[model samples]
Target: MIPAAVDAARAALADPAAVAARWRADHDGPVIAHLPYDVPAELILAAGALPVAVFPPGAEQAQAHLQGWICSPARRFLAAARQGELAWADGLVIPQICDTMRGLKGLWQFLQEPAFLESYNLPRISRASARPYFASELSRLRDRIQGFTGRTADDGRLRAAIALCNAVRERTALLFQRRVLGQISNLDYYTLVRASYVLPPEEMLALLGGMDVEDAAVSKPPAVPVVVSGQLMEPLAVAGLLDQCGLSVVGDDLVDGERAWRTVAEGGDPLAALAERTLNAPPCAVKNGPVTRETYLAALVAERGAQGVIFLHFRNCEMENLGYPGTRDHLERLGIPTLYLETQWGTAAAGAVVTRLEAFREMLEGC
Candidate 1:
């Protein structure tokens, strides 16, 4: 018999539209689109709206919508939005997470849709100046949300929203923790976690709560656990490749991965808590902090019990590419092996990545 959690997750995956429909029934508020790796989810929820992550699908018609653009990840996300795959949204929230995403905002702005639109900017680097910048950006976002929704997000209201969101996020984190502890396989975890992007957080949270896999035994010992970092355009391909290479990806710092958890900081100030958590949360190539990319990488490796770190940078992502050498050096200093793979934002390079990953696995085993 299939595990109850897996079965529940599969049901959600089979009819994501039904899930969206259910959310629409409960909440009459506008839907908000959150860009990848941005802090839009928390803000959307705080605004008393449903937060939906937009991504491109693999259908042929979807491809046609994005004909000129190479099959990049951004193109795929746009295609999905154009093809009605994300039609359930009442509005879209675009974040200035990176250059590609910034360009996407302009493209989306002129689409002439009556759907409400909002844009947010999160600090790229976690430096001395980043915290204040994030706080200000978040405050501006709160004002916009209030103006758009005509709702006041006072201390009491923000706290209630934060508590609900935190409950949902904590459940999600426990699910990932179960998988990371080797009680579940990467495939199973990916199936469930990826489904969360398409489903409403409440529904996803309930599904996770129904999961009873905590005591399940692993079929095999987890090989060196590794935390996947950087842009993950195609998580299905990345997770599949990692599994084939015999490395168990216990956790990740990616937006689409374990980092989606909502952080609830104490005090009456929700914006401050949100800003602090966004900066302190897992290592992202775009964050600004005194700690270099290498420091973040090393910390993730140790925290995740990962013997090695995989810096998965997308081709033409200059920020990550430029920081590669320093990141590698930092990992080496901590005696953590590192494998850096650069690729275009599609699964076309899966075969090659698998080969390199297998070699890396062997190298790790020999250590």
Candidate 2:
């Protein structure tokens, strides 16, 4: 049996809008919505509000509002807001990552005209000036949150929020470590992580703290271990499919997965600490940090004893596809097998994806 806490998290993820609505109805503070990758969630929490990570909605819903070729994530977010799936959120924060993402603020304004919509200028290149620039951007974001919530996210509150989120991240790291050890199944592992995106920190920590991985792993079968490097294991059923194919996802270099939690904010100044944490966090295709994505993926594979790497990318995601060739070549040169799986928003676990995974698993077993 899944722990009650984990089960609760799964339930919350199933209907995130309902969860956000309930939070807004119950809390005195506003509910803040943000996309994945960057955007300091601590500022939202510090404002005494719920920080809800808005996942992409149905692709078809976004077709009328955006070009069919626009990345599904960007399209879906716009559709969700217009369709009222995100109506409960008091405001939305969009970080400037790519041209498509940068244009979202204008699209949102022209299409939805939300009461409070703000954008943060997240630096793509990491340099000496990046930290200070990001810190200033975070300060601007804090002001935006204050404007929406009518409550200042003062330093003390920001510190408390940082400590709370940092604690949750710490516990989540432990959870993933347990997953790596075969103490949790892929479905449960990702489900618990997805739960963090919806559930408040205190509640998520409670569930994570109560997990008994020793019991959970008792009946799980051993499988070939591999690492997934991509945006996310979307539609989540993909995780279960991997398990069925005898592949254990031991680690990931996903923007929304392991990368988001690997760093903790430090130092005295909360904003500066957050900026440093953002600049220092694991390098992704979206950010030009000191470490390259290929290097990071290679290190993760070695650390986890992964025999192969699965490069999972959302179809039409320019940024994800742009960095793929080099990373693939790097892994191949090191004699590490790799597979490229391009997925659309709703076609996850489709026959083609399953076929590829099955073949990859067979090849790994033969080797």
Candidate 3:
């Protein structure tokens, strides 16, 4: 029997809009959708609303609205919005972390015209100086969210939201640890992770907190251990492919996976704490932080005793492309076998990806 938590997570991800509609009915508050690579969910929660991450499948029709060079996720998000797939959402937060994302804000504003539209400006460089600025930006976001919801995200509410989010992160980290230890399957682990993006944080906390990973009926994790570094993984099949090829993801720097759950805000001031959390997060490709991706991956691999490294990236994601060469070179120097695969989100290219992964796994076994 499927565990209730896993089943609910799968159902939620399968139909995010439906889930959002339910949240709207339950909370009587706005449902705000945000693009990935970091938008503060706590602020939205503090405003008495749900924060949903946009990760739509397939962008075939979205091509008409976007240039050919735009990344698949951007195209998919636009397509989803165009198709009324996101009609349940009352607001949209577009984080301007890169050129493509910056362009998306204008398209969304002109086309969709959500009730609440926010263009969040994320600092590319993570530094001490950036924290205060980011905290101010977060404050602005809180004000905007309050304006949309007619509910003030006051200091008390913000602190409560932070505590809830921190609990979710802690629970997620435990699931990840179990997956690395082969106590849970990849499907179970990732479903919960992705589902957290769509489900209300309070709901997610209940679901994850109630999960009994020890007693859940789950498939064995793959035997070959590896670490995956990338912007994100989508369409679910990419993670499934790792399991299919007998490859276990012992560690990752993927935005949607490990990176999402790795940190907790620390401080009495909620916005400043959130800023500190972002600045201190594991290195991200879009953020030119003090720590390099290569160094982070190396440390993760060593800490987890990974057998190999897989650099999976979304095709046409320029920010991820910029850091791949340096990270790959650094790992190669350390004698870490690395496989880099770039695929468009929701494309029928898993066959090609799996073939390459199989060869990489075989090479590792031979050694």
Considering lDDT, where higher is better, how would the candidates rank from best to worst?
3, 2, 1
On a 0 to 1 TM-score scale, where does candidate 1 land against the true structure?
A: 0.86
| Each candidate's clash count | 10, 0, 0
lDDT of each: 0.68, 0.80, 0.82
* Model 2: per-residue Cα lDDT over 199-278, one tens digit each: 88887887888554464555567899999988777867788888888899988877557865665555598888888877
After superposition, which runs of candidate 2 have C-alpha atoms over 4 Å from their true positions? Answer: 1-3, 56-58, 212-217
Candidate 3: segments with Cα more than 4 A from true spot: 212-222
Better candidate number, 1 or 3, judged by lDDT: 3
lDDT, candidate 1, 1-367, per-residue tens: 2266666665665555566677778877666666555554666666777666655444333354434533366675676666676676667777776776777667666553635777788877667688788888888888887777766767677777677767766777777777776676676777667666667766667677755555566776657678777755354567767766778886566666776664577566788887777777655667655466567667767777787988777666656766788878877887988888876544447778888999999998888
Q: Taking the tens digit of each residue's C-alpha lDDT, what string does model 3 give over 19-75?
A: 887786777888888987678898999998889987775545487889888888888
Using lDDT as the yardstick, the better of models 2 and 3 is 3
Q: Compared to the true structure, candidate 2 yields what TM-score? A: 0.94
Root-mean-square deviation per candidate:
3.2, 1.8, 1.8
